[model samples]
Target: MGSDEDAVLAGPFWYGRWDETAREHHGGHARQLNRAARAAHYAEGAFDPDATRAAIAGLEIPVLILVGELDFSPSPVLATQLGELFAPGWVRLVVQPGAGHHPWLDDAARFGDVVTRWLAGS
Candidate 1:
């Protein structure tokens, strides 16, 4: 359904459509959510960056910090900080070229390549 034009049109983010109207009318509704929802929303009404950083710091596993080139949500600098929390060889950052919030969709091959290399090294 990701590429389905009709499906996309039927959603609330669209400027026109009955479904859009219904979605907008819903008391707790919004369209086109940001990707930061991945790391931020852990529980109801809670966004714990400190806890996230702490958990990250606690981990001894190698980490890959991939962010979209155009994403300004937490920003690339923030990703860098997260990477720094780990030991020197334990973290790597891969910024997808020409990408926004969703890097996998922006450049699938590059994302795959980074993951492949990280896994091979691990």
Candidate 2:
């Protein structure tokens, strides 16, 4: 899985489908240097869950938390748990069905509709 096909497979793993356009786009734009930097950032403890919860609790604005139903790095359960840290009614958590990590890439129309409707009401 270390070849170009492996890179293409990432689209399915992330978006729930083998999106050719997305794969091609990613192939064109994904730089090794940027990937290295991102890997380093994650290794450096880019997120502290306790601090994140404390910070989100202090926010007064309405928060929309969107997560893909199939995303494993931070699963739907984790997303719900994060939303629970905020005051009731302050956070709206939406788990897009059939999606992995990139919900918009998995179902662009549905994603657009969800975001548009949420924006209209917010």
Candidate 3:
């Protein structure tokens, strides 16, 4: 697979919001320069629209859809729409303030707290 759409994915900083730490954590070093190609191959297979629809068709458990405030891939607006697909009373959507694609990587404490509260059924 090729990352022709985003050349940045071929380097240490795959996304604009990530810093050196995230790069290191995600193995962006020279040894893994080929990471992007592998990621590209899996990314397409990671989410199958038809499979997703089938999986969530009768989901009865609560769903928490969290995204970073600055994430545009599945923007806050889009996340909200996704929440709507679930039973209204069973969905909660949260956009972590000041974060990008990965809120936990950007603000670990806040991310932990948010998730903790949700898991506690707060």
lDDT digits (tens) for residues 36-73 of candidate 3: 88688678578787887767756889888988777786
Candidate 1 wrong stretches, greater than 4 Å: 1-52
Q: Candidate 1, TM-score vs. the true structure?
A: 0.57
Task: Give the candidates in order of lDDT, highest first.
Answer: 2, 3, 1
lDDT of 2 by residue, 30-119 (tens): 553486776777785778889887888888778888888998757899999988898778888899998777788778888888898888
List the RMSD of every prediction in angstroms.
9.8, 3.6, 4.6
Encode model 1's per-residue lDDT on 16-113: one tens digit a residue.
22343344443233344454873465556585778876777778877788887666754678788768877667788887776655555556688888
Q: What is the lDDT of residue 26 in candidate 1?
A: 34
Cα-lDDT of candidate 2? 0.77
Worst 10 residues of 3 by lDDT: 7-16
How many clashes (backbone atoms < 3 Å, residues ≥3 apart in a chain or on different chains) does model 3 have? 0
Candidate models: Cα lDDT each:
0.64, 0.77, 0.74
Sorting all predicted structures by TM-score, with the top scorer first, yields: 2, 3, 1
